[model samples]
Target: MPSGHANAGYRRLFDRSGLTFGAGFPLTGTNRSTPDPEAEIELAKHAESVGFDGLWARDVPTYWPKFGDAGQTFDTWPWLSHVAAHTDEIALGTSSVVLPLRHPLHVAKSAATVDRLSDGRLVLGVASGDRDPEYPAFDVDPDSRGELFRESVEALRTVWREDYPELEDRWGRLEGDLDVVPNPTEETIPLLPTGNSRQSDEWIAEHGDGWLFYHLPESTLESYIRQWREATADKPFAIAIRVELADDPAAGPEPLHLGFRAGVEWYRDYFRRLEGYGLDHAIVGLQNDDRERAFETFAAEIIERV
Candidate 1:
């Protein structure tokens, strides 16, 4: 198997040599249904201009208002394509696309299209979805999501790697007579399975090109990284963290749901420590009122220092 460096998006976000960083969307920092798209675009451009390695988006097929956050509100493919058109070299990614809700072939075509449009800067982070209502909304059986997720992943790889590949399972059959077009810029798109997606650690280690996890406590995070390193050789391990940069440069870390609040200096050392533990990448969601300045500040202080 070829390493992630073979894929441009994967290369931008991961390196066996050290850890890299990316910024996640809803960059506007809005928790509501409508985030300012124009503002988000400018922030995306700003992030790239300031040397952020990648720009990531979320896939929320249907927003249940109860969920509280709308996650960028735009559908994944077109939004990423639009971003691709505006940016030049920054990697484009999905924080995750729910695999079980969508047909594998559609995911293949859309993902390949983004990869082609972006000149191979697309890296897929796929998940099985968490919301209970979301499954029934898609006419998907909740109990079978694990199987569906596995089948979807295998299907994606098969279609991307082989032209008109024969495939059969939950979604009918492809008889090797018809093909999905616009293959990924590499032999295969970099596939990072988000969280467990109902799969075991062993399954994720074997099938995923990388692993995307949420923020964990320092000890737990270190343990996961160590276990991942032992199980998979050279594959990247990534985490998406919510960041709240305190005004004090030396403030200690306080917990958030999937991340923490701390001073830039602490973050710098924390990331360095993570790098020492063999972590490869981090996707940050900046939770600050003045996010633009926070981005510049973090980039200058934390990113540069790290």
Candidate 2:
């Protein structure tokens, strides 16, 4: 496939319909429990069956004592690898991997491996480190993550694109005959940026394949997206919603940090507004206290509705 200009995966979610929706991890750490992929696989298959555009996995390197939620409680890559084989068509993604914490070369290698195994259906999202506790444990400075993230993205691009791609960055060197084998199906894989990561608008506009924005009201979503367009002026914009769906359509809106609790009707209406706002994608974060019930209800209700 020709890379960098336009491709099927990018065009499907980022171009056509102007609305790409995907389910975040159905499990977000409740009830002293962790997500079981075997159990989750049934739900994933259901999602694919129901026509969700994609499924996103997250990387939580540590469970912080201060942080109440435990996330999906699995290393992201292994989970993605397992599910990629189990399902047939749904695309796989990472809401984000903390790039500053890992070597970019390793990330390139792993991403390429998953993309190859899945037959070129990997969309990698990356970000600077957020958990303050994690930075020290890895002997990396949280304050300097923005710089590291830029370096990491650049390094990964080099390794993915050219054989022993020449390096001229603050990160390091890839001197002689080194190369990352099995370059992505496209000349490169899509690298979606999460948040600002301390990058200037120019840097983001120039480098980011797509942009991820967190929690915005319908109107706010419109304004932010407009601003992103004005800033980047040429790139695609993707947004994420932290959603908790209730069984009843009239359950009303309750507050979560970056999301809300609403019923299926409201969910549909709200998403429609986002589509009108020119939002390209909405990655829904499902944070149901009841795991099995949440997945089942969403599949029957919203996923089926979409």
Q: Pick by TM-score: which candidate is best? A: 1
Tens digit of per-residue lDDT, candidate 2, span 41-98:
8777876776667888777788886776556677777788888888876778887889
How does candidate 2 score on lDDT? 0.75
lDDT of 1: 0.90
Q: List residue ranges in candidate 2 displaced over 4 A.
A: 1-8, 26-33, 168-170, 289-306
Query: How many pairs collide in each candidate, listed in order?
Result: 0, 0
Worst 10 residues of 1 by lDDT: 1-10
What TM-score does prediction 2 earn?
0.89
Query: How do the residues 238-284 of candidate 1 rate in per-residue lDDT, one tens digit apiece?
Result: 89999999999999999988889999889999999998887888899
- lDDT, candidate 1, at 289: 95
Off by over 4 Å in 1: 1-4
Model 1: lDDT of residue 269: 93
